[model samples]
Target: MINKKDIKTLIVKKPLTLDCGRVISDFPIAYETYGKLNERKDNAILIFHALTGDQFVTGKNPVTDKDGWWAYAVGSGKAINTDKYFLICANVIGGCMGSFGPSHIDPETKKAFGTKFPVITINDMVNAQVNLLDHFKINQLFSVIGGSMGGMQVLQFVSNFPDKAKTAIPIACTSSHSAQNIAFNELGRQSIMADSDWKEGNYQNQNLNPGKGLSVARMAAHITYLSKKGLENKFGRKLQERDDLKFGFDADFQIESYLRHQGSVFVDRFDANSYLYITRAMDYFDLPRKFGGNLSKAFEKTKTKFFIISFTSDWLYPTQENKDIVIALNSIGADVGFAEIESDKGHDSFLLDVPDFLNVLKNFVDKSYEELIR
Candidate 1:
């Protein structure tokens, strides 16, 4: 229920050139800012959000009645320490939250773009953000930080614009999407497209929405976001609003209630077609080939400092992946640090209130800032 009134849109004709050899014309990128840019324009920190996150990262979402997604780690004195840095968060180019995507009207057909939105790559996404930065007149950023898909963008940003950022932090991310990971995303897309109500991504005008498909997709994806230990600790065999088990697919356990809540809420805010587009973009992201088919060559000239973080229990992108990235960075003799925080919270731990992660974030930002100022 985002109030169209408060939302401001900036449109760029042919904003991003897709890796699929198509150009996204007359695109709009939705963004929100916190704090003030310094006179030198060097205090700006770009914060990238994951698969489902929007521009509303830290502040309260007046439109949804829910607290901002990363409120716990952002804000005045939080881990990001916005009070000390100029924070910029934008909905990725292919996202649905106020950004141009399938739901947007296609000037060519005078209809919703729907599934016709050009396929994009993570580099394309970072390239769009660079265009937005140009529009804002930000020549350089203090740091770029993100998790999950957001982390993928962070890494791509460094690879694409190595000299533009003072530091880059890619947490809970990998150098490339694995076949197994791509399979998971493909299943989600299949769920959405398989729904009878999807109507080939034209459901919006057909008076039908692919809520069931989107919800099921969300449910399956949500499981990957948490750890088995976390699930057991939070909702192990717990009954759901009942004393006796009259199990007939009626949410017999607390875990079922949790997953149902995640799925239902996800459908209300997200567009099914955009989900397919964004995930496809992530699947197509790989830097080795982009860097002339050698991962080590990507960072060969990057002067930007890097801080790679991962979690022990994150099965989605394990610590091994982070280590491989570190190895590549080291092979190029890049200034990089790796911190694999011991946590059982899984991939979602990056966004959660993990004290260890917070300490690392604070330390990395402070250290990077000191290096820049000195």
Candidate 2:
């Protein structure tokens, strides 16, 4: 069980109006910090978490007792190098981890808000997070960075607060969620809702955990994170435990077993309602469309240095979508740099230990710091 007291929180007394025209105040924003903030405070980097990620960015997650999601890329002497920078990661509003979400008891009804939680947008998410800057007294961040949904937050952050970050990195993500991506998210949502145990998202009140439904949703979404080549190379036609196909739809292949494990473990850490809400927020994201169909205009006012990354095998966001961001920044003459990394790890590549990705990222931050000091 996650002990809420173990998590750090900021209760924003300021009311926030959501995209759905709902106003919430005094809500908790759970976060974790790493390293020490120097006297200059300019060494701070605010990292946004992806859909399934929490405030745990590096080291051991207190709640899960597992390696943080970006453990391979962050820490002392790693890419982000906490030894030389202050890192802050916050659980997004609609997240399960000690943050304000549907799982929280509604003050009015004294029951879990469940689906009654106001629908949030990527815009609302970033706006709420910007309060962290005020909390930390950081005038400007050294950089704002993240991958996938996190990457979308990076873009929205820069667009919403043009002068708040010195540099930005949006990795393996799209400015707008693609139709295919929306369809995939919908499949996950439907899988969860289809389970009878869900009880219209009120399972918590009835002591019923819709684990089966949530597990299937996770299994479906997990497949989208990997490439066909990656899956074949890793799991192939290998049998799970038997040599022959005594298969009656019973874990015949290693791939099936692997996916089952992923789904099972995911349900232990995630909430079903959160999965639905966050994916909906992602599906609703369309930065270009929000800015009157001109992507360039979104960043026209910001001078933040951009370093966008995309993997060769990431069909979810794809190299083209990442490049579209680059093209838009370039059209307005924004300081932007891009790299199309050669990898078969699909959309999940950015979270893994890809040497080329790590090296370029490290150099950019270190060199950018040198430039900042100079």
How many collisions per candidate? 1, 0
Write one digit per residue (lDDT tens) for candidate 2, span 280-372.
999999999977999999998899999999999999899999999999999999999999999899889989989999999999989998897
Off by over 4 Å in 1: none
Q: Can you list the residue pairs that collide in candidate 1?
A: 14-26
Global lDDT of each candidate: 0.86, 0.93
lDDT of 1 by residue, 56-133 (tens): 887877567678888878889887887888888888877887877788878878888888878877888788877667
Candidate 1, which ten residues in sequence have the lowest lDDT sum?
1-10
Report the Cα lDDT for residue 280, model 1. Answer: 90
TM-score of each: 0.97, 0.99
Best by lDDT: 2
State each model's C-alpha RMSD to the native. Answer: 1.4, 0.8
Q: Give residue 218's error in model 1 in angstroms.
A: 0.4
Error of 2 at 181 (Å): 0.3
